[model samples]
Target: MPYQWPTLTNWLEQIAQPFYQQGYVILEQAIPADLCWALYQDVQHQQLTAAGVGRQGQHQLNQQVRRDHTAWLNQNNPVQQQYLQQMAQLQQDMNRRCFLGLIDFEAHYARYQQGDFYQKHLDAFVGRSNRVLSTVCYLNTLEQGGELLIYNEQDQLISRVQPNAGTLVIFESCRFPHEVLPATTTRYSIAGWFRQNSSIQGRIDPPQ
Candidate 1:
């Protein structure tokens, strides 16, 4: 049987309400299980490069900050297209309900091997970037380690998320600082951002 992705209407309330009250929301089994499995398989076959910090001119591989491999999601692949489509629906709903004015979303498959970790960081800074919302969709479960730690603006720990297949997390990009703790086993997930168009000087900003 083919996997039928759930429409945003089915889960929008769960996402929108918390996001409205706080700055983030986390949901389990957010995507179809079969779809998550397919995406996991797709990533296994991809050629991933060591991920870097910063963007464009400032981008550089800094293992001290992060240690992971990543491959940008390609819309050409059917499995990836399905996932992207789901995110597209999310983007639309976010704009409609939250007035985020999100114009686009970009994502990449991320793999964290044993002992890999990402240092605490913010996805975007006010007035410095277009990213408005940050997202993470887990494709595989882990027994231990590989927890995502989210912090409040005051630098207090708030949420500790254990990687679980089909879990999705969304948060305001500039309001939260988060990090991936060292993985005891391999971890697979998709990290993404919703952005508003920040075109300037007659040139469109490039996607990362």
Candidate 2:
């Protein structure tokens, strides 16, 4: 089925309320499983630069996954183009409903194989302002050992989200200390952030 905009908008509103109160929300079966897999392949085939430091363990993916990924927002093939547009519209509605100003969706594909992981870190800090939210939609289900762990500032495990193809994980961009658990098999995800124009948005500093 094609991505349904009106239905998605309603779903976003339902999820956004709790997100505002608790700082995160999860939507199950939010996107088509097959389309998500296709986009993952397209990203894997594209040239990827290394995403060092910001990542951990042995993460590997093509160029789109490595650099600032918003540049490829419009490069999808026709069918995938529809999916991308729906995502963009959903993002816009989410921002308006949440009263978070304007939100820009910067999509990224992450590929992690055996022992690959991303160290615990916040989504946006330096060089970006108004980054109020972070979202990740799983492309496929993994065999084992890959989990999205959300932590508080004091390092308490607030939530642990296992991969469910088509489900979306939404959270505050600044408060969560999150990381990808080491992957036993290859894992794919579309990871991105929503940012506003904060005058105090600091310069991009490497994770300490």
Candidate 3:
């Protein structure tokens, strides 16, 4: 069967409620198990390139900061399209319930090799990008390590998330400072962001 998630309204009642109460929300089995494995297989066959930090011209490879290969999601691909469709519905529900005014969604397949890790950082800074919410959908289970740690605005550790397959993690882009711990083994996931159309200070939302 094709990928399908819970109804938008029902899903929000359950998923978004916790999201607002806490700084983040985790949805187990958000994506079908078969779909998760398929996505993992897709990444295995994809020609992933070194992921860079920042956007466009400022984007540069900083392996020391983040060591992962990535491939941007595109609608041309069936699997990616299906995954995106699910998120599109999520964006609509988010807007209706939370009034986020989300305009678009972008995602990419991220694969972290053994010993890879991403330093603590914020996904979006205020008045910088349109990234309102950040999300990660784990495609494969991490054997050991490769945990995600999110910190509060005060820089205090808030929650630790294990890389469990078919789990979706959602959090505010600017509010939470998160990092991926060292990957004792390879890890596969889809990382994405929900964007708004409006920009601040006459600047583009994001140059990506």
| Best prediction by lDDT | 1
Best by the TM-score measure: 1
TM-score computed on alpha carbons, candidate 1:
0.94
Per-residue lDDT tens digits of candidate 1, residues 130-200?
Answer: 88899999998998999999999999999999999889999999999999999999999999999987778
- Give the lDDT of residue 181 in candidate 2: 82
Q: What is the per-residue lDDT of model 2 for residues 28-142, given as tens digits with 9 covering 90 to 100?
A: 7777555665666666675544464433344345433222222233444664475667567667777677777644555556676676777677876645445667888876777
Ranking by lDDT: 1, 3, 2
Q: Can you give the TM-score per candidate against the true fold?
A: 0.94, 0.75, 0.91
Q: Give the whole-model CA lDDT for all candidates, comma-separated.
A: 0.91, 0.67, 0.86
Evaluate model 2: give its TM-score: 0.75
